[model samples]
Target: MPKLKVLNLFRIQLSLLPSSLGHLINLQTLCLDYSKIEDFAIIGKLKRLKVLSLQHSDIKELTTEISQLTQLRLLDLSNCGRLEVIAPNVISKLSQLEDLYVQLCPIQWNVEVLEELKGLSKLTRLELDIKDSKMLPQGFFSKELRRYNISIGDWPARINGDESLRTLQFKVNSTISLEEFQGIKNVEFLLFANVENGLDELQSNITPLFNEKV
Candidate 1:
């Protein structure tokens, strides 16, 4: 009989767990949010991990061993204020990953990182709330992105041109020009948060824009 891993505790406050968590080779899901975990080396060893949520944690950085979890499908590190780096190679190995949310995390949105994410053909949804918009590569929109939520300092020159995007949520102060929405078709959801009068002109032209309630 295969062994069953047991890790069930809610809202426990611990600065860091012993490295012994690596022993749970059968661990498939791990949720350590609202905890005092300042480091993430212990969870890196769970080779079978698929779902990991570290929201609102005080973690400073992610270990390179995070790439070892090749089977990971969903990873949420939202609101990790101290996180500064995300290893490119580690992100590249997550070929099977489907959903990724890194909102409010300080990750360098660079060209290489964008290229690596584009390589992950399986990623369907991505939510990134970044402080700087210039760091995002021009080709970041090339991959088969289905849903995207981004906070940019300034809108990109253009969105993905070749493929069809389903949804786009942009948190910007400026209005999006009609040219930027050229290649996009059949978009079910479109959100422009914290905008000024930029959307007034578009509101009359953009056909069937999603409701504000959505």
Candidate 2:
């Protein structure tokens, strides 16, 4: 319908969206959670879209067409295990984005993608993965974020507290200068996994948390 504002296509395993879907210019919220559809070329027509959920979808690449949704506030790509490429400059175009979720996806994190995220001044919540601590750029995370659940490295991390807390879990064996990450001071929950070196150096950096590493 031309006046449709919301569409919940949850759990529907379809290969394609009806061509008529593009006519919903006024559509505001679209939920495609757990769907198998891949082609999203028509989504760009929904210029008024505020929330787009593709959680558990079978999409392999997030095309640049999605950047047309300039009004989008929330974009969920959580559990998209097969997702790979996120078109360059696509995320930066979502200037109105407040929350973004890409956790549990295999997209290789890079400095360019991280820099694009930094441009989203309005972003308040984020959930994503980094293949390793070394992938993180200096001052990578935005201090504007009020809530986040970030896992760095290969070790699996738990999503804690229903997204109410800012957490960072690192599974690395190398030294990390905590000062490089501006958001560390705001982190409420932090975990270091498999740490084998620089305990003394780490202790000197954050005295309160490193009194004695057991």
Candidate 3:
């Protein structure tokens, strides 16, 4: 029998994939999204697999074996509700990785994880949806970052000192100061949603900051 090279097993209502899937060594893209898949060890045997998407699945933890697929480029786990831990060493081995979307995942954000990712030079885009503002990682606003999108339960007490950031999209409730816009010379787009402060106050505070730049 010929080997299956691609599979879109998403939304199949399956909690576990049959071990038979391991036979498809040539598989590249495997999407098990919206399925109740909580076990990932079955597909760990596929050495050539890449582009794994487990978004919206019930997966609680990512196995270390995920690093075996060195060719993986995009890994999306946007809504894995029970997810709590991410093995940093497993993720650091993916040298070719570019896009990582972990929004709504319950992974505990920590300073160590953020520092580790700084070594992932291939990462240029990041999206985070965290429920706790205190859980946010520091140095995430560094100049090396190109794009950032964050949705937190509360606005950060401070937003400034990022030099290379070009785009910033945030949903918060805290007041934004005019000084926060200084030193951000490349910012061309800014999106603030669900803010408690009035738009007029925000505009008044920001208009002067951008008058010379805009």
Off by over 4 Å in 1: 5-9, 154-167, 171-186, 191-214
lDDT string for model 1 (106-172, tens) is 7666657666776887898887665554455554544556776655554443233223445565544
Candidate lDDT values, in order: 0.67, 0.81, 0.68
Regions of model 3 farther than 4 Å from truth: 135-138, 143-148, 152-167, 170-188, 191-214
Model 3 weakest 10-residue run by lDDT: 154-163
- Assess candidate 1 and give its lDDT: 0.67
For candidate 3, list the clashing residue pairs, or say none.
Answer: none
Regions of model 2 farther than 4 Å from truth: 157-159, 173-175, 181-183, 208-214
What's the TM for model 2?
A: 0.89
Evaluated at residue 2, the lDDT of candidate 1 is 26
Scored by lDDT, model 3 comes in at: 0.68
How far is 84's C-alpha from truth in model 2 (Å)? 1.4
Error of 2 at 59 (Å): 1.2
Give residue 139's lDDT in candidate 1 (0 to 100): 47
